[model samples]
Target: YIDLYNENHMYWVTADMYFKANQMGLLDPETYTQKNEDYSQKINEGQVFYSSMEWDFDAGNAELSKAGGKDKFVDIPWADTAEFPAWISRASEFGMAARTFVVSSKCDETKMKAIMRLFDFLFSEDGSRTIMNGPKGITWDYDENGVAVLTEDCKQKLKENPDYLLEQGANRYLGLVGQDYDALSATQANEGKYIDLRLNKEYVEENMTDADKDYCDFYGVDVPLEVSTKRENQSTIHEGYINLMPAENPTDIQRSITKISDYLQQAVPDMVFSETQEEYDQKYAQIQAELKNMGYDDVTAYFKEAWENAISNYKELTAK
Candidate 1:
């Protein structure tokens, strides 16, 4: 569960109530069969809030509430919550079943593929357009130029600020199902403009050094060119070499990398979710010892060779 500070109230709570409800077996296949009927009742009863997993950041609340809250709100909860089963309660109260899934880096490829397919169906042209876009010539209309232009008053309201559109149902970019390429491109373009303006003000001085001026000039060309040098260097090295070289002498690079990675992986979960620092340290030492016993020296030599090769290639490339 996560907690947030509401403006009027000191503490407001947010949590993965939907997932929790599903896990508790509050929803079943029978409930799923009557979803629409259930949803209609809930909406009529004013018991439903349109919440989505995409609502990760606090800004999502603004979108959900149509920017109802005051400015400068603070989120209180650091993790998902168990208390307020809002989604589940609404679903059950309205007689709808809920199915929940957790998607993260740890999820297997099969699960990811299934999730992706579900999203694609929901966000496809026909699906989203039918459900979200409202009837023709009403919420949105087409221009003479054949662009999907919102009506004048609606456009004016949205144009009051770009973020207004984004917050209030700009599902084109924020939808879960498909990649909104046009929205993505527009966001990138806007970001580039902001970056260029910031760079012009901060780094583009008349009396700047040649190196600084050259760097600024290069940025004007294309960001990819500047990134290519870094990418080339990275491609030559075993990824493990970067972390291994940071440890003390006689330490194996591969072993050090493994130890550190394992330590961090375990430490984060323990410290954030389960145990105290003392408990984490106890497990961390055992992991380090195991890494050492697993031929850390040989791993270090392999990493060193990779690093040397990378460095040599970088030097040769830069010489030109």
Candidate 2:
């Protein structure tokens, strides 16, 4: 795409242009425009070939709705066999199932009990409701049919402040420390966009709207968690690497990771704009060589050892 443009038209290429070109900002106009006007024009005029993934589907949907369009971004299963041949046949596990919780050693017995109780509550249906929708009569309430519904007041408050629920102390206090996986899972059970199709049978039969059913049909999942669990069970490779604890001596490994990240930041654009396939291959090889020189091997060895130890420990503990 870039080479043909370069040969056919005398397009000015610069460092910034090269970096941003693959993101589909080649003709963003080197001038200022109002943010709203710019986005509306770019989207409505079809100036964007592919929208950036930085925006979640909800955000993208909201933005497009402003210009009288439905959600342009929706979830789709994607697999690249040429780049990841081994992964082609495997059903990769979803990341959300790997929920972990840790209690601070500094906590007393009282605090520990409180934390345990909170965790227990979050596992319950009502607790999940509060985590997701805030207190009754504020963000949500049950209708005559006993189905939970968002209140108009909640919508108004959300319009004024998107973080109204969090600010109003909807979720457990522990959630303030970090993203509470248990709380998050409960919330997903109640109102998760992707998993709404696969809600509990009773909940679905009673609570789902026609629109909700349609959304579920679009995604082809009757139950959100079942789909994730199925993929995880089918996966040949181990899951939850991102959730793993780092090595004790992580400084050198972190440095190497950063170096490789920085190299990719530049090399990706270089490869994309390369004139020929040979040029692209050379750039990729250069990236690999640079990363290898920057202690990539050492970092890999450290993580590999840690992962193996974890597996061994888990097996021993479970066997007992």
Candidate 3:
């Protein structure tokens, strides 16, 4: 709606970034026609410097290890500016907490209690270790600091064959109790090592490629991930926007919305293609008038109103 992105000006912020790039002649001329896959390919071929969704740390590291790459790529946290506060998008699966469990109405209270016990154990330190690593003594154990550590034999096997962890029966993800196998699983065991043996500091160091070592030195980190760890403060997530869609689904509004979207898909590129900043500004100002004539105001108003109601509803729901 009108206010859908008004509060944060996310709509304009994105436009400004892209348009500024265009004004500077920094954007690729083929930008509008290129697909996400093309972006990924560019990154893999070392033709890209920045792309938010092009790939993650793992993929970048792996792809950049090719013969000519020299492994120059590394994950760095995106810092926020006063004008643009950044946010980390969360995985929808991790947010699906309530959707992960259910029981039949016909189930007895005893069965319900048993199910709860199962959840409790799954969340317990020992159970979490079992779920993430394997039965403790079999694959891992606690050290003097009471942190989870992979047994020497397990480490040796992993060193010899990377797939050894899979054979030891790890990451049966269906049984997780709202968290992943690393932080919580290991943190509960007295804040020792990562529950996933592969993520342990020693294992990671032992298994790191020469490129990983170089990145660690280049970033002044003892481990390659230290860069991200130090910059964790820069990352944040806000769940507010997840359910802010307009509640009403009137066909006419939907049509108007679709029309505006389709128009902007072309109009924005036209604005970016403008040869001069003055021309771009003129096009932008003209767009406001054209959008109003195309029912943009009415559609925005409906969605803005719906967004307000959705916020109110969300507040009430959370309060309960």
Candidate 4:
């Protein structure tokens, strides 16, 4: 949820980043033409300094490895400055579960219990490990010391086959199985190791580059990089609450919302490419006026009222 009713927020999202980008000349003539692969290549070849994690991490590393190894990219926090002392970080929003996971419903208690039990196993440490690797003792097994390790055959397949995970049944039915990274075996025979191979220090040394180490070390982490990093950054998550008061249903305002979306698609570029600071500043007011003319005022009224109601409800719910 967002406070779109506030014009300041609107300005911050729309005009602020681009205005600052323009002032710094970050938007070069070639930016509009750069494709996804082009950006990745540029980052890989060291033509670009900074890139988003999606574009660079794997792509840059593969290219670097081919070039007899080089320093790679890492995910760093957005820098803080005097004017902006705080950063509001949020996790990826949840998507429709029906699309992500298969769902079934039944009134029978027996069937329901069976389903629940299946899910319980699926989410558990051993079950998740089974889904991620393969059948225990076949694909992976306990060593003499009790640490779960990939079998020699599985290791050979992983090295030889690019499609091993899917073709060999590890994550082949990934849509049905959960992908939890849980620690392996709790018994005395077992040493500390993760079911997910990516989290193992040995796996990291053999597969991932030194960049991941730097990223973990930057945050002063001791445990596997992913676990420690996610744990340490939990406090930075700003908002996870559902918006109890939603605006008018999308179907009711689809036309206006669609138009506004289209308008903003063009509006952003126009404002971003403005010739001067004065021109860029006026573009903000112009877009705001145009939005109201396009019935955004009525739309925002719904949000403003909703925001008030939601806040009121929240306070009441939380009251001691």
Q: Rate the local accuracy (lDDT) of all candidates.
A: 0.38, 0.50, 0.64, 0.58
TM-score of each: 0.27, 0.53, 0.60, 0.59
Per-residue lDDT of model 4, residues 20-134, tens digit only: 6767877544554578787766666677655434445666665666676646665555333332233322221221122243446645788788887887776555676777777
Better of 2 and 4 by lDDT: 4
Candidate 3 global CA lDDT score:
0.64
Q: Highest lDDT: which candidate? A: 3
Query: Which RMSD values do the candidates have, in order?
Result: 20.0, 9.6, 5.9, 6.8
* TM-score, structure 1 vs. true: 0.27
Worst 10 residues of 3 by lDDT: 88-97
Off by over 4 Å in 3: 1-49, 54-57, 63-72, 79-100, 104-118, 121-139, 166-177, 180-206, 231-276, 279-320
Indicate which candidate wins on TM-score: 3
lDDT, model 3, position 4: 31
Error of 3 at 30 (Å): 5.8
Comparing 1 and 4 by TM-score, which wins? 4
Q: Pairs clashing in candidate 2?
A: 198-222, 198-223, 198-224
What is the per-residue lDDT of model 2 for residues 1-320, given as tens digits with 9 covering 90 to 100? Answer: 12211322212224334535635646444222237567656655555444334242455545665665443544333332222222212111222223456798999999999998876665454555666556667767766875566666765776677567677666544342222222223334344421111233544444344544555676565642333433422333433333344534578788887887687666766666666657755775676577678887787777778877766765565477
